[model samples]
Structures are given as C-alpha cells and as structure tokens.
Target: MQYRKFGKTGETVSALGFGCMRLPILNEKSENIDVKRAEEMLNYAYEHGVTYFDTAYVYHRPMHQGISKGFSENVLGNCFQGAKREKIFYATKLPTFVIQSPDEFEKTLHESLTSLKTDRIDFYLAHSLTKQTWDRMIQMGMLEFLQKAKESGKVRHLGFSFHDELPVFKEIVDSFDWEFAQIQYNYLDIRVQAGTEGLHYAASKNLGMVIMEPLRGGKLAVTPTEEVRNIWKKSQYDRSMAQRGLLFVWDDPAVSVVLSGMSTLDQVKENVRSADSAIAGTLSDFERSLYAEARKAYWNRTVVPCTGCEYCLPCPAGVNIPSNLNIVNELAMFGDVTLSKGNYEFQPPSERSENCVQCGVCLTKCPQHIQIPDHLQKLTEQMK
Candidate 1:
C-alpha cells in the first residue's frame, strides 16, 4: 500500500484507512453483524497493508431499534490479537450525542477501550460534531478532558469528525489544537459541508486530514446513470466507477488518508488495489475535467433546477425555498430517497415546504423560472 505523511505528526500511515462502521450484517439487522465474514474482510485488508482502523462507540448499532452500541469495537477486537493488535493504529470516537457533561468523557473512554481490548487508543476523535454539540463540548470543558486523556496516555492523538456548514467547521478547527480531522468530501460535494476550502484550511494548520464519505456514502460507487457513464467513457484511463471516486479524493496531496467502509472481501481487494496505485497530483487536466463534467451530469438529472441562490429567499410564507428543494435534488443525484427523506426531517418546522402558501412572490425573483410553489407542494406530498 502507498503511504503518506500524516501532517504535523510526520508519521507515515497507509493512504487507505479501514472504516469499521459498515461491516457485513445478517438477517437485515444492523446489530447482528456477520462476524465470520467480517473477520475475513478485516484480515485481508490488514494483510494488504491497511493499518488505520476507525470505529466509533455508536457504530454497528440499530439506530431505529434502540440496540446497544460498541459491537463494532468488539468485533474488531476479536479479529486482531497477539502481535497484530499493537501494529494496528486503532481509531475510535467518543459519541457526541451521549456526552451530557464533563464526567461522561472518561466513562465513555474506558468503555471504548474495554470494547477494543486496548489500553490506549492510537487516534481518538470527538464524533460527529455539529454547531450545537461543539458548543456543549466546549462549555463542558472538552479541552481539559482531552488534555487529561493525553497526559494519562489513554489517547495518543486527538481529532474530530464534522457534519456542519463551513463557518462552523472553521470555528471548530480554529478552536482546538487538533491533531487531525475527518470530513465528508467527494467530487459531487465540492461545496458541501467542509468542502475544498475546509480541506486546505486544516492542512494549513498542519492538521492531518482524513477523508470520510469519499464515495458520498456509496452513491458514487454504484453503477452510474447513462449520462454519467457516457462522460466517464471519454477518459483515457480505464477504472471502475468506485476506483475513480476514491482516486479523486486521493489525488489531493493534502489528504493524509481516505477511509472506505468495506463490507465484502471483494471490496477490500479492489480498494487495496486502488490504494496501491494512489498518487498525489497525478490526474491530467483533461481527467480532472471529467470529474467536473460528471458532477454537472448528476445535477442535470435533478428535477428542480435550483442553483441554491437565495434570490427567492425571504419567502412570504416563511418557507426555506432553497434548502427544501436542495434535498429533492440530493435524492435525484444520489438515488437514495430514504436518506433524502431523513434529511428533510432535520429542517426547521417553520421552514419546511408544508409552510409554503403558494404565493407568487418568489416567481419574479427566480432566475431559473422554476414553478416555486408547485415544486414546494410536490415536495410536501413526496416527503410525507
């Protein structure tokens, strides 16, 4: 496997990190992991040179069914034993949602360490930080907790995984002395949460950057639509859609590692092959253009033509026009209606499409001439 320098640490880690969130499962149950199959996949990946193993306290739990967490850490702990355990870089997170106070920090740390069968964690993160959770963490003395954890030799390095707007991302990065960060990034999500600008800013601070959701949660890895496939055909290099997606993230020199949550042995083998050939700054100008073209092709498939411009904002009915429509566009682009529907639930009740009064005020301001109220009505029905 190819290796890259991990930012200020100057330590060389495998270009590809193994994310333990999506191991194979049985009976359509998230908590009922298929251990034998998962063990084989993990063993193959480790033998092929993937050393960074990332898990979390809440990984492999049934979110809807209310199952207890830590199955992922237990499974991983069972897979590697003897000398293998010390060689691997164990990375896991302190669940942000469960952190109600400063006291919960150490309690949770010991829980994860016990689950992993490890005394010290190699890389620990504040998991899934948003603006609200971040503020709560600070107010509860996160900095002091981290310092104590490090000084006690329980956690070797500190980092965070983000899922918020760029401004909040920048605030979190600047607020702490972080050793690394993980963010959602892909060719299609160039301007999404912690996009290109966030990547460079963290690198500027000498923080090692780990890329999560490099395939946009497996959307970019699937068979492309006809329009996107035609665009990929023009490229001189022959690669699967998934490999192309991964290489796009690995192409950046600033990235320390790209995490892939492999569920099958075939995926482990294929990703290992891709990582072996991953090099920074190798994409030709023309090849890079294909990514941009592919992105546009996906956008073209969206039902709404909203450019996310706020010109139609300040809705008379208090509806958030751009935000609601963007969720529909995300469904079209990624072909994941269930995920898109879940995304809609996060919107404020006052800003939801249900609040649109079918007023014609936004029609005059919209440059695309989209039927604003008509789409809002459709969205309300579809999401329901």
Candidate 2:
C-alpha cells in the first residue's frame, strides 16, 4: 500500500481508502446485511493494505426495499472488534445536518461512538456542512464541543465534509484549525462543488483532503459510448477505465486519499493493483491530452456544463432545474437512455420537468441565464 502523511499529523494513511458505503449485500430481499459476505470483503481489504474506513450516520438505512440497511457501522465495529485500533484509522461524521440545538451535537457524537463501538474516533467531521449549518455550528458552540472532545480524547482529529459553493468551502476551511476535510471530486466535476480550486485551497492550508464520489457515483466505470471508448484506445499506456479515472486525481499531489466504494472482492483487488502502480506524475503528456479530449467530447455531446450551483434555483413551479438538466446531460453524455428515462419517469408528477409553470423565477436568478423552462420541456420530450 502506498502511504502519504496526513496533513501535519505525522501519521501516514494509505493512498486508497476503503469506503464502507457500498459493501456487498447478502440477500436480495432484505435490509439486514449478509454479515458473512461483508466480513470476507472487509478482511480481504485489510489484508491487501487499505487502512482507512469511512462511514456515516445514515449509511445503512433502507433507502430502497432491496438494499441492505443498518449494518454498515455495526458490521465495521464487529469486523475490527479485537484488532489494534491504532493500526487502522476509522473515520465517521457527526450528523450536524440533523441537529436543531447545541445539546444535539453531544447527543450525535455519543451515538456515533456507541454505534462504532469505539472509545475515540481517529477522524471526526461535522457532516455535510452548508452555509446554514456553518452558522448554526457557531451559534450552537460546536467548535467548543469539538475542542472538548479532542481534549477528552474522544476525537483525534476534527474537520468537515462540504457540498456547497467554493466561497462557502473556503470559509469553512479558514474558519477553524482543521486536521483535514472531505470533498466530492472527479475529472468531470473539476468545476463543480469545491472543484480543483477547493482542493488546492485545502492543501495550501496544509489540511489533508479526502475525496468522495471519485467515480461520480459509479458513472465513470460502466459501459462507455463509442467516442469515449475510442479516446481510451488512443492512449499509449494501458489502464482500465477506472484506473485512468483514479490516476487523474492521484496525479495531483494536492489530493491525499481517493475513496472508492467497492462491493466485491474483484473490485478490491483491482483497486489495490491500480494504487500500487499509480505513482505521482505517472500520466504522460499524451495520456493527459487523451483524457482531456475525451472529457471535452463528453461535455460536447451531453451536458449543459451546469455546475449544480442552484444559481438558477427557486423555480416558481417547484421544478428541480439543475436536476432536470443533469438527467438530460447524462442521457446525452452516457447514452444511457434507459437510466435517464427511468429516473425522469420515477419523479412524482408534480416534481417532473413538465410541471414547470414558466413563471421565469429561475431565469432571473440564473447566473448562466439559461432558458431553464425551455430546456426542461426539451429534456422531457427527448427523455420520454
């Protein structure tokens, strides 16, 4: 396993961290985990050299009937129960997004401890902080609570995971003496939330950066269009689609760890192999050009380049403008007609793109001034 020092902590963490969100499920019919299978995967990952495990409060809730629920944290606790806890760094978040008052911070922290079956967390984050939550944290004395937890040995490191604009992200980064921070990053999302700018900003402050959705929620690995596949073939270096995507982030020294939510033993092995061979500065000029070309092709074919900034928000008719654009973009970029259609159709009729009342509220707010209502109508027509 390749190791990198975590910020200024003098602790070396694996370059490829194991995300516990998408562990293998045993049964097709229940939310209860197939413990035996999960154990095998976890043990395999540990043996192969992954040392970082990330989970959250709502990780295993039954989002759908066929999905396994309420087993991630407990299963992890059981899996690493008797081992030297220091050998592995376990990171989880305090669900501050759900808090209504100051007391709830302590309540959530204690609950996370109980659930993980650990005395002290190696890294703890103020989960999914937005502008609103950041304000609340100050009003509720969250920083004091974090300091107390650190002093009492309940948390080894304190930080946050972000999902808002760059300005807010920078504010949170500069707000505290943080050990590290997490952000959503990928090749296609460089200009989106936190983006490349945010990554460099965190590194400049000497904060360890953890990456989530490195694969864009598994979109990067699935079947590719002819144009994307052709671009990959042009590369002189041989690598899997997943490896190429991972290397893009790993190539940047600013990124500390790239998290992949692998569910199978094969995935674990493949990722480990990729990590072993993926050195900094591994991608040559030609390879970088190929990737850039492919990305350009993808953008040209499918997306409007909307960054989900919600600048065009507050649609008077309650239409989710950005989401509608994304569905259209995915359909055009990936050519996954079925997926695009299914996601659109599953939306409640009131929430569908067709529900737009064309009141122009979103148009006025749009930074891009996109004709959102017209785009939504066009998207619905194409998708249907």
Candidate 3:
C-alpha cells in the first residue's frame, strides 16, 4: 500500500484506511454484524497494510429491543486482540449531539476506551460536528475537554468529522489547533459539503485531511448511466467508477488518506489495489478531464441538489430527508424510479418521506435551502 505523511504528525498512514461502520452484518436488517466474518475481512486489511481503522459512537446502531448493536468498537477490540492492537491506529469519535453536559466528554471517552480495551486512542474525533454542535460545545466548555484529553495523554491526536457548510467548516478549523480532519469527498461531491475549497483550506493549514464517503456510500461504484459508461470506456484508462472516485480524491495532494467502509473481502481487495496506484499528482490533464466529463454526465441526470449531508435530520415529523432525496435522484439518473420506490419503501415507516408533515422546520436547516416538505409531497405522489 502507498503511504502518505499525515500532516504535522510525522506519521505516514496508509493511503487507504478502513472505515469500520459498514461491516458485513448478520442479517438483511444490518443491525448486527457477522463478527467472525468481519474480523476476517478486517484482518486481511490489517495484514495488507491498512494501518488506520475508524468507527463512531452511533455506527452499526441497534434500534430494536435486545438487538445487540454498538458492535463497531467491540468487534475492533476483538479483531485487534493481543499484539494486533499495536499494528494499526484505532480512531473513533465523541457523540457530540448527545452530550448533555461537559462532564459527558470524559464519561464518553472513558466508555470508548473501555470498549476498545485500550489505554489511549490513537486518534479521537469530535463526531459529526456542525455549526450548531460547535456552538453548543463552546457553551458547554468543550475546549477544556479537548485540552484535558491531550494533557491527560488519553488521546494522541484530536480532530473532527465534519458535515456542514464551507463557512462553518472554516470556522471550526480556525477555532482549534487540530491535528487532522475527516470530510466527505468524491468525484460527485466536489461542490457538496465542505467541497474542494474546504479540502484545500484544511490542507493549507497543515491539518491531515482524511477523506470519507469516497464512493458516496457505494453509489458511485454502481454501474453508471450509458453516457457516463461510454465516457469511461472511451478513456485510455480502463478504470471502474469506484477507482475513478478513489483516484480523484487521492490525486489531490491535500488528501492524506481515503477511507472506504468495506463490507466484503472483495471490496477490501479492490480498494487495496486502487491504493497501490493512488499517487498524488499522478492524474494527467486528459485523465482529469475525464473526471470532469464524468461528473457532468451525473449532473446532467441529477434531479435534486442534495448531497446527503443530513444536517436537517431527526425531522420533527420523522422523515429521512437526505436518503429519500437520493432515491428520488435515481429517477433522473437512470430514467427509472423502481430503485427509488424500493429504497423509499425499504426505509422504516417512520423515516419514509410519506410521513412528512410539511412543517417547514427543515427549510431553516438545509444548506441547499430545499423546500423539503414540498419535495417530499411530490416524491410521495411519484412513489405511489
């Protein structure tokens, strides 16, 4: 695997880090992970030089009674049992939304340390930080919590995973002396949350930039439209959409690592192979043009402007706004809506857009300023 110097840390992390949120699950419901199988996949990644592993406070979440969720960290503890723990860097996050008080900072950190069966976290992040959460954290004395974690020697590096507007991201980056940061970046998200501008700004500040959602939750890896496929097929390089996605992110010298939430062993292998060729500044002018053309093909077909940032979440009416919009986008992309309809139905009854109450609260929160309720009403009609 190719390695890059993690900015200001003097540590060279593998080009591909393992995002542990989407492990192979025990059932179609995706609540419980198949631990033994996941461990084998993770073990393969570790042996193959994926030195970074990331999880979160709410990943692999359990919703039902006795569903046995929160396996992300526990499974990592098991996967890195014994001397394996020293072989890689373990990264996890603080659940910023649920922190009622400043004291919960240490409380949650202690819980995470215990769950991972480790004394110190190699990298600890303020999970899913938005402007609202950052402001609340300031009021709750979060700076002290950050300082204490470092001074107490419990966390080696401090950073955040971001999901807000570019201005907000800039504010947070300037607010603290962070060692690294993770953001959603892909070919399709060049102008989305945080976008290319934010990526360059963070890199200019010398904070190690770790990329998440390189595949847009596996959407970019799927078969492209015939037009987009022809563009790739006509290109000199025989690269898959997924490879193009990974390569585009890695082409930027700002990107320190690209994290893929690999669910299957095949995904791990494919990503690892991609990592081998992921040299910074390697894409030629023609290749860069191909990515631009490919993105145009998607934009030509895309209906909604949503980037799935999920900032307008926990809808008072219980609608899954971002995901529902993604399904709706499939219609414009593929010229069919069956995938959208199926995906919309697959969402829990409470999370489906059909439950929208047209309250307009999401209007104030959405970065794109979407008329969310109005769109949901139209989508509900289309689905029906």
Candidate 4:
C-alpha cells in the first residue's frame, strides 16, 4: 500500500507491484493457470492497492502457449472490468530479442496490445536486452520504431529490461534517453549482472528502476539452511525470510518498484505487508550485519560463486553449464540433496551435468578459470 515516485514521471507507483509470471496454477502445472484463482488474486491485489500489474509475452505456456495467449492478461483484464483502467497501470514488454527485422517490432507491439486488450500500455520495455540485442536494435532502427509508437500513443513510457554484463549495461543505459529500466536484483545477486551498480546508475540518470527476480526466481523465499535460519533469528526482526529479503531491496532508495510474482493470496498479503513497513534507513548496523551473515551462510551452502560472466558458456556437449553448476550449488548449500537430485534428473539429457563431454570449451572462456568439466563430472556423480 506504500507508494514511491516513479522517477521523474511524477507517477506514484506502489512499492510492491504485482508480477504475473507465477499466477496460481491448476494442480501445480504451470501451463494450466487456474484462471478463476488468478482472477481472485488479481482482484484481491487490486482491492488492496496494488495498481501495477506486470506481464510478459512469454508467460504461461504449454497449455496456454504463446506470448499473447490471453491466459495472464485476460484474467487481469476481467478482474479490472468496468474499473478505471487509468487508475491501474499495465506494463508489458516487446520481445525485441526475438525480432529478426525492424518491421517485426511493430508486429510484436500490436500483438501485445491485442493480447492485453488495451490500446495504450502505461509502461513498455524492450525485453531482456543483451549487448547483441541492443546493437541489433540500433542497426534495425528500433529507436525510430519506438518514436513512432510514442507518437501514436501506444507506448507512454520507454525503457528496457537488462540481462547483460555491467559494462554492456552502462553502454545501453547511456545509449538512449530511457524513462525507466528493469533489472534482476536481490540480496544474493548484489554483484552479479546489472546488480546494485546498474540500479544506482539508472537512478542517477533520474530513470525509474523496476526490479525483477527480487526473490531470485523464488529461491530466497523458500526454506533456508540451519545456518541461514539462525542468522535470521539473530536479526530479531519479527518478519519471515521473504519479508526480510523484500525489505532489503525496498530499503534501497534507488529501487523504484520491487516486483513479486505471487501465485497465492497468502503471498500477496505477506508481500503487501512487507511493502507497507519497508522504510529506507530502517535497518540498523546490527540488522545489516545479520543480513551479511545470512548472505555468507547462503553462499557457503548453495552456489559455486560463479559470476556468470558467460566465460563458461557454449558447452560443446550441450550441457547447460552454468545452470548445472547453480543447481549443484543450491543442493549443497540448502542441504537438500533429494530436491537437487530430483531437479537434475528431471532435466532433459542435453541439459544434465552428466552430458558434459570434458571438451574444455567452457574453461578457456571462463574468466574464473574454473575446472568446469571436471566439476560438472563430480557434481553429476554426487547427484547420482
């Protein structure tokens, strides 16, 4: 229910925006979105003052399929039916990453509009901009396309969502006069791609910063290891782990809106309460130390500390090299070998760690010089 000024736009957005990536599903199947439940949750969030709803072109798939499938946006539109659309700002992305030509940009935009059943998008962003995509956008005259959209009143605010290295992030930020930008930020990813640095840099330009993956794709909010739980207890704050994690992000003044992809009413309520009490400068020195200790505990247990510099990419054997390492790290850190093993085994053979052919293609590219093939073999054995 708390609000913050969305950069210099003078629009006050709820600190906790509703992210529609993980709407309630039927029988735990992501593809079968429980539309009735989703509608109820959306209405509940709206009734409780969550005015910002974020969806994307690639959410709810298999059963629903496609970006404009209407499973997500349609449910939201139904919930807000007969209500003032202007009071609730709708945000979606143009999948420019998948565009092969300049004309495709307009096609994607019109598709998104039709999907959401809205003519004007309150906030529109270039989805998942890598360095390559940014350059391609320029080469294909994407700016001209955006200007045209703005002139037509289709997109009110222009921005981008990022997933590249810090240097490239700076390049993209400096490339255009963006109204806002979205980045993946959380306690565990402070130094990762477009971490706190990108957030601060964008804010420095007076551009509103929208945060995604605030829970690291729901990792931080789940149950923690004994060490992490002890650290949370020591913090002496009467809040759950999810609240603590959210408070950390919202406490930073640079953060304009912290998005949570909640699927259940309980999650919506918990996050809304966290947002209500999340004030900057509320964490004392001791509380901050507790958070640092918790982070160390998490790092010591779950992840291999890979910086994801993509030096270990392009595995010759088709192994999802970084993703496998991350899974191993999560299992080790959380002391949940069963969950980790299940996750690893459920993946397709091409993505499994055992698929590593020891080709050493990932090693030379690795900035950390990690023995990737060897470590992958070890992880595969351990999981087995």
Candidate 5:
C-alpha cells in the first residue's frame, strides 16, 4: 500500500481509507450490521495496510430514527481488540445537528470515546457541516470546543466534513486552524459542493484534504450505460470503472486520502489493489480526458436539469422535489429503474413524488426553470 503525507499534520496515512458507514448489514436493515461480515472486511483492509479507518456517530443509523442511532463506533470497538486498535488511525465525526446546548459538545465526545473504547481520537470532525450548521456551531462556541478537545487530549487533530457551497467551505476553513478536512470529490462532482476550487483552497492552507464519495455515493462504480462503457473501453489502462473513478481523485497531489465505503470483502480487496497504484500526477492526458467525455455521456442522459440546489423545496404537498428529481435523473443516466425505484421508495411516504399535488408554488422558485409539477407527475406515472 502507498502512503501520503497528510498535509501540515506531518502524519503519513494510507492513500485509501476504509469508510465504515456502508459495512455489510443483515436483514436489509441499516442498523442491523452483519458484524461477522463487517469484521472480516475490516480485518482484510487492515491486513492489507489500510491504516485509516473512518466512521461517524450516525453512520449506520436509520434515517427515521434521526441522530440517535449510533452503532458504528460500538461495532468498531468490538472488532479491533488489543494491539490492533493502537495501529489504526480512527477518524469519526460528532453529530453537529443534534447538539442542543454547549454542554452537549463534551457529552458527545465522551460518548464517542467510550463507544470506540479509545482514550483519544486520531482525527475528529464536525460531521456534515452546511452553512446553517456552521453558523449554529459558531454561535455555540464550536471552535473553542474543538480547541479544548485537542487541548484536553481527547482528540489529536480537529477538522470538519463539509456539504455546502464553496464559499461556505472557505468560511469554515478560515474560521479555525483546522488540521484536515473531508469533502465529496469525484470526476462527476468536479463542480458540485466544495469542487476543485475548494479542494485546492484547503490544500493551499496546508490542510490535509480527505476525499469522500469519490464514487459519487457509489453511482460512478455501478454498471454504466453502453455509451459510458464504450468510453471506458477506449482507456489503455484496462481498469475497472471503480478504479478509474478512484484514480481520478487520487491523481491529484492535493488529495491526501480517498475514502471508500466498502461493503464487501471483495470491495476491500479491489480498493486495496487500486491503492498500490495511487501515485499522484500519474494519469496521462488521454486518460484524464476520458473522464470529461464519460461525464458528458452521463449528463446527456439526464432528463431533468435540476441541479439539486434545493431552491424548490418544502413542496406545499410535502414532496421532496430535489430527491424525486434526482432519482428520475439517476434512472435516465444509468437506465436502472429497479435501483432508482428502490431509492425513491426509501424516502418517507410523504416525500415521495406521488405526493406532489401540482400546487405550482415551486414553479417560480426553480433556478433551472424546471416544470416542477409536470416532472413530478411524470415520475409518479413512471413509478406506477
């Protein structure tokens, strides 16, 4: 396995980190983690030199249960016994959305420390910080809290995982002296939340940039359309779709580590093999251009131009406009209604596209000028 200097932190971490959120689960329940299977995968990753293990307080929790569900840390504590725990750099997040008071900060940290059976977290983050959450955290003295965490020896490094506009990301990065940060980056998400500009900005400050969703929540790794497959065939590298996606992110010298939420031992093996070749600035110009072409092929299949900006939200009829449209776009791009329909059904019954009442309230709000109700109606018809 290859290692990279984890920017200004002066620590060397494996190029590939094991993200424990998507561990194998039993009986189709998110919280019902298949412990034996998950342990096997973790052991495989560890044995193969994946020293960075990332989990969160809410990783495997049921969405309906909100932030209260936190079984991931306990599972890790259970799996890594004795000396195995000391060698791994455990990275986890504090559930920023649920903190009701200043006291809750220490309360959550203590709970996480106890759950992980560790005295100090190698890296701790403010989980999934949006602009609203960042504002709330600042008002709650979150920066001081992080400083205290490191000072108290409960956390070695302080950082955040982001999901907001690049300006908001820059604001948070500049607000505190963070050691590292996590952002969603991939070939497809170049211009999305904390895109290339944000990646470089964080790097410019000498902060270690940990990349999450390098596969776009596993969409980029899934079986692609025939157009996308043909484009991959043109690559002389002969890599799998998953490796191609990973390599694109790891190719950047600014990326300190790429986290893959591997659910199976096979995935662990495959990703570890990819890490062997994760040298920075290695992709040829021809290989780099393929990603751009593949992106266009995927975008060409998009039926709705909705950028998921969430401006057309709080649908008067309770429909989740962006989510519904995203499923439609996923179906169009990948031609996988079976998977897309499953995702659509996963949303609350109230948030389903079928709940759209054609209120026309969202009609004027959309930035893309999407015919909101018409598309929701079409989604409802297609699902039927």
Candidate 6:
C-alpha cells in the first residue's frame, strides 16, 4: 500500500485505510458477524501494507432488524487479538448522537478503548457531525473533554467526520483546533456535501484530510453507464470503475487517506492493488477531461441529485424523502429497479411517499431545493 503524509502531523499513514463498517455477517444478522471471513480480509489487507483501521460507535450497531449501526471497533479489536495490535494505527469515532452530557464523553471514550482492546486511539473523531451536533459539543464542553483525552494519552489525534452543507462544514473546521477530518467525497460528489470546495479548503489549512466514500458508497465501483463506457473507451489507460473512482481522489496531493469498507477478500486484494499504483497528479489533462465526462454521464443516469443529506427531515406527513429518492436513483445507478421497487413498496404507506401532505416545508429546507411533495407525488403514482 502507498502512504501519504498526514497533514502537519509529520506522521505517515497508508493511502488506503480499511473501513471496518461492512464486514461480512453470518445469518443476515448485523451482530452475527462472520469473524473468520472478516479476519481473512483484514489480515490480507494488513499483510499487504494497509495501516489505518477505521470504525465507529454505531458501526455494526443494530437498532432494528436487518439493519446495522455496525460498531465495527469490536471486530477490529477482536481481529487484532494478542500481539497484532501493535502493528498499525487504529482510528474510530465518538458518536455525535450520543453526546448529551460532558460525562458521557469519558464514558464513551473508555468504552471505545475497551471495545478495541487498546489503551489509546491513533485518531479519534466526532462521528457524523452536523451544525446541531457541533453546537452541542461545545455547549457540553467537548474541548475540555478532548483536551483531557489528549493530555491523558487516550487519544493521539483529534478529528471529525462531517455530513453537512459547505458553510456548516467550514464553520466546524474553523471552530476547532482539529488535527484531521473525514468527509464523504468522490468524483460524483464534487458539488455536493463538503464538495471540492470544502475538500481543498480543509486541505489548504493542512488538516489531515481523510475521505470516507471515495467511491460514493460503491455507486461508482460498478460497471460504467453507456455514456460513461463511451468516455472510458476513449482512454488509453485501462482501469476498473473502482480504480477510476479511487484514483480521482488520490490524484490530489492534499488528500491523506482514502477509506474503503472492503467486505470480501477479493475486494481487499483489489483495493490494495489499486493503492499500490496510486500517485499524486497521475491523471493527465486528457484523463481529467475523461473524468469530467464520466462524472457528467453519472449525473445523467436515472437518479435524482438528492444526496440523502436529510436536511429536509421530520416531514409532518411522515414521508422518508432520502430513501425514496435514493431508490428512485438506484433505478439508473444500479441499472435495475427490481430490488429498489421491492424495498420501496415494502415500506408501509406512512413511511412511503403516499403520506406526503404537500406542506412545502421540506422544499425550503432542501439544499437541492427539490420539490419534495412533487417528487413524492410522482413516486407515489409510479410505485403504485
């Protein structure tokens, strides 16, 4: 695996970090993790040179059936049993949703350390932070808590994983004397959450920039769209869609690490191979144009630009806007709507668009200004 300088830390980490949030599970249960399978993949990745492992409080967390909050630190801790712990960097998060009090900070911090079977975390972040969470963190004395953690030697680095608008993201970045940051970025999200603008802005300040969804949650890893294929066919270099997605982020020298939640040994092998080839400014001017065209073809796919931002939430009528629009997009993104439609239709009418009340409240809230009621109305008719 290739390595990069982690911002101003003067420390080096693998170009590809292993995201342990999606380990293979047994019996279709999130808690019933198929550890043996996971160990093989994790070991393969580690042996090949991946040095950073990222997990979170809710990773593998099961709030309901067939769902995963995926508190993956447990698996990673278990996998790194015995002497395996000293070989790499361990990164994880403090769940923002659980931060209601100052006392909860230490409680969770210790719990995380215990779960990982480690005394200290290399990188600790405020997981999935939004404007509200940022304010609450300060109101509840997050600074004191982090300072204590650092002084106590429980946390080596401070960071945050963001999921908000650009302004809010920058606000949080500037508010804290943070060491690193994790963001959901990819070729497809150039103008979405914490887009390229935020990426470069954070990097300019020399924050160790770690990217979570470099492939847009695996959407960009699939076979290309016809338009995308046409563009790729013109390229002199032969690369998989996943490689293209990953390389786009690595092309920028500012990015420190890219996280891939590999679920299989094959994925581990494939990603490590890509990481071995990653280099800054590897994409030539022509290839960059191809990237532009590929991104355009991606947008042109049968999917809404609704990025599941959840800004327009708590619908009075109980409509699940993100899920519906995402499924709608999957009609094109995955090239098949059978599973999407099945899942969408499986939701009770209340959770589905049939409950849209046409209040227009969500419209003003949406960053994309998506006509929520209209989209729901159309989806209701189409799904029926």
Q: Judged by lDDT, which candidate is best? A: 5
Model 1 lDDT on a 0 to 1 scale: 0.89
- lDDT-better candidate, 2 vs 5: 5
TM-score to native of every candidate shown: 0.85, 0.88, 0.89, 0.90, 0.97, 0.89
Angstrom error of the Cα, residue 181, model 6: value is 0.6
Q: How many angstroms is residue 185 displaced in model 2 relative to the true structure, after the best TM-score fit? A: 1.4
lDDT per residue, candidate 5, 143-167, as tens digits? 8999999999999998899999999
lDDT of 6 by residue, 231-312 (tens): 9999998888888989999998889999998878988899999999779888899999998987777678754778787899
| Model 2 poorest 10 in a row by lDDT | 61-70
The alpha-carbon deviation from the true structure for residue 275 of candidate 5, after best TM-score superposition, in angstroms, is: 0.8
Residue by residue across 150-265, what tens digits does model 2's lDDT show?
99999999889998889999999988899899999988888888999999999888999899988876678777799899889887777777888888888888878888888778
C-alpha lDDT of residue 384 in model 3: 94
The lDDT values for all models are: 0.89, 0.81, 0.86, 0.81, 0.91, 0.84
Scored against the true structure, residue 96 in model 2 reaches a CA lDDT of 70
User: How many backbone overlaps does candidate 1 show?
Assistant: 0
Measured by TM-score, the strongest candidate is: 5
Clashing pairs in 2: 60-70
Scored by Cα lDDT, where does model 2 land? 0.81
Single out the weakest 10-residue window by summed lDDT for candidate 1: 61-70
Cα lDDT for residue 211, candidate 3 = 96
Instruction: Tell me the lDDT of model 5 at 320.
Output: 90
Candidate 3: Cα lDDT at 251: 97
Score residue 286 of candidate 3 by CA lDDT. Answer: 86
RMSD in Å for all candidates = 4.6, 3.4, 3.6, 2.8, 1.3, 3.3
Clashes of each: 0, 1, 0, 5, 0, 10
